[model samples]
Target: MADLVSERASEAKEITRRTALERGAGVAAVGAASALAAALSSSSAAAAVPGAKAQDTSSHSRGTTLPTVVAGVRIPDSQLTRAVTEFARKVSSESLFNHVMRTYLYGSLMFDRRGIRYDREFAFVAAVLHDLGLVKAYQTPNERFEVDGADAARNFLRGRHMPAERVEVVWDAIALHTNVGIASRKRPEIGMVSAGSGLDLTGNGLQQIPADALTEILAAFPRAGFTQDALDTILSLCRTKPMSVLMHPFAEVGRRHLSDFQVPTVEDLLLAAPFEE
Candidate 1:
């Protein structure tokens, strides 16, 4: 018994140590990206057209048009957008961050192909932050990972003083991104977020994008072992927070990857109720 206890303690220490290292790496990457963005913003301002229409000069505006357009999709370039990107970088592993970026770009391409009108910035924000629950910084012990991510995104936007209605849209987009039928029936932005992420994870809508555009998108954000990394992250969450995965599909991940996973199934809960019926 004493040997078993010591082994468990050692395992716990290792998990904590690895988590700390991952977070440290994320922060370092964020810092480098921020410095590069600032330098590029300054250079763009210096080379601006002499008499172009004045851009929004608010704190949210970057005041320069450094080319953020990638693969015919224009990624919004503003102070607020940069902040959103930087925050994701700080909280997410590189593979996960790249996955979110691909999610946005893939969704944007689909929107363009279908001639669907939507708010680009809102969609981008929702897409990038959709997996926040999977990251250590935004995870909660009890909520479904989707809800945790949505709540985190909502709080972040509200802290920025975004309007309630707009914030709600983003919340729905993130929260329902995994709910296939329901999400697709909601507002356009919500549907796009779900569809985009679904495409990246499962190739559900690969036929919607042309081969050339897909090539370009992948080139910009290489998968970089995203599939295995994502699986490990999910399995980690399942191990640490079994309750959070109880009613969600993540329960299956726990069952498959975790030898000790014993969370009750929906049917188990239903049949085990105290009622005499």
Candidate 2:
């Protein structure tokens, strides 16, 4: 059956991507109490999927002085693996969460390769820290919501010797991550700017959020911080992020194995049940 073949293809593609994450997660897990480890643990909810294997435990805490965080090598944990998992779940693991993260890394790497001059640091940090606002929102009042993401990123970036300016860029990007084309006002260590939040479950590419939900998110970022151009650019990438797996036009950007399954729409997204926690 056509459906059978499509599912097989989707699964095969997913396996290829997951293998990449297993190797990378192995690298991230090498650190003791590292961002990578914390991030991986946080995604315990997503790891509930059947047959998900543990990353090789050897790499992370292998008795190192300072963990190795290189240009291409990404140690996903908090802002990273977790964020990517959230995106995959929002789409019902349509692309297999691990595979989606792998694809995202590929996209980011491609962007960097194409003289984008970006670093995986921002992308990794932004991804891990992006949804931190959600955690903050649950703990704080709605007015404190938007500030939560930025505040968390600001706090985490501090001890790492992240330059004041670059930290500022990441903070701003996190604050308005839900919006689109935010420039990382903060100086980047690897010249890679922090793209905004990867929080959209629907992938509508919104960074500023709808005016109604703006109260919590906007509490940190004033209305003036909203930038239409930045928001649009982010949306464009998020939109094109799933052409291969999502059955969309730009899916040509990657190989979307959507023969058996189609990407969820806003309607399908709404029908999904609330997470019980």
Candidate 3:
């Protein structure tokens, strides 16, 4: 028992050390991307016409303009939205980044179809940052991936000086994004984040989107083997933090992928509770 405990402790320390190293390496890249995003935001604001709707024109590289409309859904181009996009692009893997963009677009189309009103910027930010926890830099050793991503998004928005209430909403949207039943019952923005991400992953609402629109969205953001990549990412977290996956769907991923994965079931915990009866 002592040996087992020591081994697990060593594993935890190794995960933490590796995560710190990865984050340190990523810091420089994130800083450069953020600086450029800030400059673009400034330039766009300066070039804007009074009372004109903001257009999606931010670019990561010279001579490239991000599309303003994808499948008839207008992408938000506010300063904050631009920053969120740039940050997600820099931090997320290509497959994960594409998944989030599709999540936002799919959710937006669903909102339009259902005649549901939602804040585009809020929903977009939530969707883009929803999977941040799955990234090495954002992953935490103890928290569920969803909560880790939620906390990261909250910190990012708070750094940008977003309003408190709005920040909370985004946090909820990201944190509860995986809990379809609960999230779909919350605010329209929150529900859209869940609905959108779920649709992208599971295609539960694929029929809601038109065939042409689906084709256009897929063309704009290719899946790039999102299913396999996403699964592998989740399994990575499971291997590192088996305890964190307990009571979550990620536990199943660990069970299927990790031969040595072992987490106590709810019934086990109940029976072991401090009760003499």
Candidate 4:
């Protein structure tokens, strides 16, 4: 536990320092640091279960076997599923691919608990491709990583002949998964993707889930340093494309992790807006 805490603390500090140096925005750095601190605190609290010895699965145990069922439901193994799985595996590390799988499982479980009718396949697609921008193949400089990921998902589903509305839903879900408060109010598909990822990433909604259910999910899709891997992935993207993070959801995170990234604040944007005095 101490080691986990120490590792998270160091990761947070590095991200915060980089973002601060890159953007030269003290305020953004402070905000990013606070958010990371809160995430670490929430994660530590969630792990306070009885007899919890291991914080995450060891590297040796990863890829040994993945369960066929999660959260009391059998995972689908369609052609599309296989394609998406292969695409993500080719781009992401094993740990990140597992994280993506858990995102779907957790999202679907949340919908089931609410008695809501959700398109399980849609959730699966959205969650599976949610982090494409973090991979080198999908990285783009013109938009936020979320938008880039959304575009990639949109293109993939288009090739599969998915209906326009369904593809749009997946696109929106992936694009807005990082947005808090708003995603939950959108379509069920969108809401679940956002909420599920949050729960898996930071334990933000972990309290609402049954302990046994969470235990089952983790046992099936173990997190092998997912926290560090995710942070490192984000930092790497910011490093490669420092300006891309200027005004996106990860703006503050970027400002904290890169020494060369700088962007306009809301006030600056307002001053520069058209029709300004």
Candidate 5:
């Protein structure tokens, strides 16, 4: 009896570990697997997951596999569209825009953390719009934007019939998702999935940025116009944010559905991590 209790206690201690790295792997893998199963099980069920509406799956080009969208629910609410439009208008500059884009892209592919249905949907939508404050702060990298952005998102969500509690998840994911290195009491699936895949969204830790001989993509194609501006903006952003490499992985995986657009980046294949030794 004592031996069994000791064995159980040992297992309990091991399970009780709050190691940040372990948390990252567990949350990411579990979230990814759960989404995959849902995608296979039912499209409507899959559609219920949070942040499930990102059009950018190109970030999954890294070794990670993205689940298929079963239910195919695109976030088409008019209120959500207005909110997203407002946020998009606020974004400018290559670096900041790419960071927001990649965060949504890779965060969706990697984590898609969904806890409660309404909150999950609302928070994910908020994540998509989290960086609008940057437009107000082109002069200063003020921390105030974090608070402001969260507030803006909360108002938009609450106005959309999203409950108040769910608004906080949106607030928190928008506010804290960037700090992937520091341990958090609660980790967002979006951050863990992006970080666990080593895709690097915030550009916080890295030794080298991924390479992009995106020459094939930079030029205008005969069939469709070249996205020179988008490509240029992305490249410019790449110089600064190493996690932007997640773009590479995204493009490769989400090809046909995302063609003509230069693949986001096949970042998962890169050998060097941007983290400095």
Candidate 6:
């Protein structure tokens, strides 16, 4: 445990607060989304999840334009997209905000490559706000970050008078983006967002992605120390709210950092249950 703490301390030192702030600063202001779009048609924007490779060898294409449209659907400047980005950017750290952006771009590209049709607008909203729970504004002890983000997203959509069905779709996408196998089988939009997140964090399905398209997205958004930034968020939550870690992947962070943390396995749950006499 001491060794783990020391190692984490060393890693944190390597990624200084100033360095993380610089990455956030690098994201062009919201108005530039359209300009970014015109640039690559144009590109993208994340995070570390456990068991996922933190390294990405792809070079980022630096661009001032943030794409308003991607994978043949309008994003960024759309009503829901705009609301989510504006709210998210205000509350989320730069690294997290950028992660959401990359989620949209990577998810959109994945769907396009697979001949799958999706709701681009919903994807954009879901991707941008997927991590809203990480931001202080939405943090709560009662629910996991995913649930907080989903609730916040649904409210945002409802406020805009979006159809309830569409709101539900976006809500599901945000809630399920981290659910692995289950998400990929839900609505097409939900599956894409989840799959896109996997691609960015772990390079899970990288082979299916065209090299050129990936390059363009990275060029615009840049990883910018995303892995470290995201890890920080996960670890912080684990220390502050250990109960929330039970079912989510972030539980790994809790198990590693919290001394009393004990993740219950399937057998443990079964033995503890109040079944049969």
Whole-model lDDT values for every prediction: 0.64, 0.34, 0.66, 0.60, 0.34, 0.58
Candidate ranking under lDDT, highest first, comes to 3, 1, 4, 6, 5, 2
Better of 5 and 6 by lDDT: 6
Which candidate comes out best when scored by lDDT? 3
Give the TM-score comparing model 4 with the true structure, all chains together. Answer: 0.71
Q: Rank order by TM-score, top first?
A: 3, 1, 4, 6, 5, 2
Q: Better model by TM-score, 3 or 6?
A: 3
Q: Which structure is stronger by lDDT: 1 or 5?
A: 1
Cand. 2 Cα-lDDT: 0.34
- Colliding residue pairs in candidate 4: 18-256, 18-257, 18-258, 19-255, 19-256, 19-257, 20-255, 20-256, 22-258, 22-259
Alpha-carbon RMSD of each model: 12.8, 19.3, 11.0, 12.6, 18.4, 13.4
Candidate number that wins on lDDT, 1 or 6: 1
Q: How would you encode candidate 6's per-residue C-alpha lDDT over 1-277 as one tens digit per residue? A: 4444444334333555643332122222221111111111001211221122222222332223457654343455665565566555544444555667777787777788678987677677777767656654555674656666677777666777889998888877776666655577888888877777777777777787777767777765677776666566666666776545543456655677768765543334445544598
Best candidate, TM-score: 3
Model 1 pairs in collision: none
Instruction: Compute the lDDT for candidate 3.
Output: 0.66
The C-alpha local distance difference test score for the whole of candidate 5 amounts to 0.34
- Model 1 whole-model lDDT (C-alpha atoms): 0.64
Model 5 misplaced stretches (Cα beyond 4 Å): 1-82, 89-98, 112-120, 137-143, 181-277
TM-score of each: 0.74, 0.34, 0.77, 0.71, 0.37, 0.70
Candidate 1 ranges with C-alpha deviation above 4 Å: 1-67
How accurate locally is residue 147 in candidate 6, as Cα lDDT from 0 to 100? 66
The residue-level lDDT of candidate 6 at 114 comes to 77
Q: How close is candidate 3 to the true structure, as a TM-score?
A: 0.77
